[model samples]
Target: MQQYAILTYHQIDLAPPPPAQFRSLYVAPSAFARQMACLKALGYRGVSMRELLPYLRGDRVGKVVGLTFDDGYCNNLERALPVLQKCGFTATCYVMSHLLGKTNVWDIENGVTQAALMSAAQIRQWAQAGMEIGAHTQTHCKLPLMADADAMREISDCKAELGALLGEPVEHFCYPYGLYEARHAAMAQAAGYQSATTTQRGKVVVGTDFFQLRRIPVVRSTFMPQFLLKLLTGYENGKGA
Candidate 1:
């Protein structure tokens, strides 16, 4: 069986998080680097979602894993890139299109840290460094409550905007808050995205949904033992999600 773990991440730094949110959203840079090193040591090559498509399609599969970052925080390029480059891997960052060069106001309103997102130039630079840029909507809004046209614009328009910014086709997406319904997938498909990722936790196997793909979350609290469990069994604490 062809299997892969699509690992998802957010801000990756050792800086203390703001007083409001769970620490799980902040995976330490050392831990992030260690995770990548572990994957490589185990003979797994971390790949971008775009690069993992063929393996997902039942072609030949090696020990491959997919790495992704959500919200496109500046630290992704500033901190995660070097670790990834050291690991001989490439990954994708899902950018909130309209929020480039701005702080994460959405998370702030929800009492999370007011972290800075990547500027347009930083995004371009990351892409130039061989990382893939995926769309994460214009405002990082959830899709299920949105009307058809609104959802289409969030999904489709964001893709177009990022493609223009990166000077390449943006063909992957991620639903905000990992919340979605079937209609959202249709919107993503109509937007010309080859695939979309979700927060649903599991190891990806053959026949996984291209649109509603599950991801293994690497977070601050995922220490070595728990991380090993997730990699070995596709679940954390055996919850499977």
Candidate 2:
């Protein structure tokens, strides 16, 4: 009955605050470092989904949790990586393949900052550093709303593109915005991803879905007590409106 958490984050920086619309997702750099350091202090070892896979198969079952960053922000390289390295941890970055080397136009158009994304070279450096690059679909498409065929194409093609770019098997996927349907799971399975994660809040247990896995969303509102409580207990403290 051993359990572990898969933690998800989007951006890492100390920027005062993003436009009100996107504020919840960015964790200040000082806070991010403190968060990781807290885990290290608690004897938790942050691992990539690549490394945490065996444990999900009823093996390992060690004091390890999966770490993931969505959107493949260049800040994940410029800011997050050093914190991870300092804590002796590895992580997975889910990239929107069709948008590599470009700004997050999807969010930019919505009034968020025009954040830069990791280039192919930066992603390669992440891979070389023992991190994993997972697919977040080619255009960050929401598969739940697309036709099955288009959904399949989105699921399969990003795996193909990133695998080709990295020169290695791309085995992990994460649904964009944690939005997906059962059919999307079927599509991802067909695409050959060994595991996929969702934005749902929970810790990984013996019988969690390998393809539609759950993750705890780490955000700016996740202060130390709340962060530690979520990591240790899977119960997120709700913020009031």
Candidate 3:
């Protein structure tokens, strides 16, 4: 089988000092640059979900890695974009339709450090710069906990809302907090999404489920060797549910 590693990232800026929750989610800008450079050096093209679709569908094959940023952060634009452009790569940033220009308020209950999400203009710039913008929902809510009707609306309406913003079809979707159920997968498919990625730890292959496609996360603590292992080998496969 042809396997591809879809690497997940969040913030791409300096990590806040200790005691700030979810520090693992931040990847220092310098480190991110190095990682992208390493991929380029290794002859791998870091691509967006849109570009990786053919490979995932067995239509084409090459050394490509799906680069994705979850919960669209302003730093992703400020810090990650230049590095990606320098590397001649494209990535996907999944933004919450209703939360643009706002902080991650849904994480307040968990005491997670609030970070500014990309504003509407910044999102447009991201798209203008050849990056893909995927939908993360209207609000960053856990789909499995919501009523079915509400969950469906979150799934479908986000695609519509973001499509309107980008003036093109938003073909990708991602579950909030990586918390979803089988029904949510069905909902994503019904929402007209080409694919939906999850927090599941594994590499995707040609036969992998499109809606529940697995991903490998890159975090603050992921050093280069480990990152390469996750990206180039089966180190992360079968590790998460």
Which has the better TM-score: candidate 1, or candidate 2? 1
Instruction: For candidate 1, give the lDDT of residue 150.
Output: 92
For each candidate, what is the lDDT? 0.87, 0.87, 0.94
Could you say which candidate leads in TM-score?
3
Could you list the CA RMSD of all candidates, in the order they appear? Answer: 1.6, 2.3, 0.7
Which candidate gets the maximum lDDT versus the true structure? 3
Report the poorest 10 consecutive residues by lDDT, candidate 2: 232-241
Q: Comparing candidate 1 with candidate 3, which one achieves the higher lDDT? A: 3
Q: Clashes in each model (backbone N, CA, C under 3 Å)?
A: 0, 0, 0
lDDT of model 3 at residue 34? 93
Residue 120 displacement in candidate 1 (angstroms):
0.8
- The residue-by-residue lDDT of candidate 3 on 149-204, one tens digit each, is 99999989989988998899999999988899999999999889999999999999
Global Cα lDDT for candidate 3? 0.94
lDDT string for model 1 (49-120, tens) is: 888999898876778889999999999999999998888899999998899999888876667767889999
Candidate 2 lDDT, 106-162, residue by residue in tens: 775578777889999999999998889999999988788888988888889999999
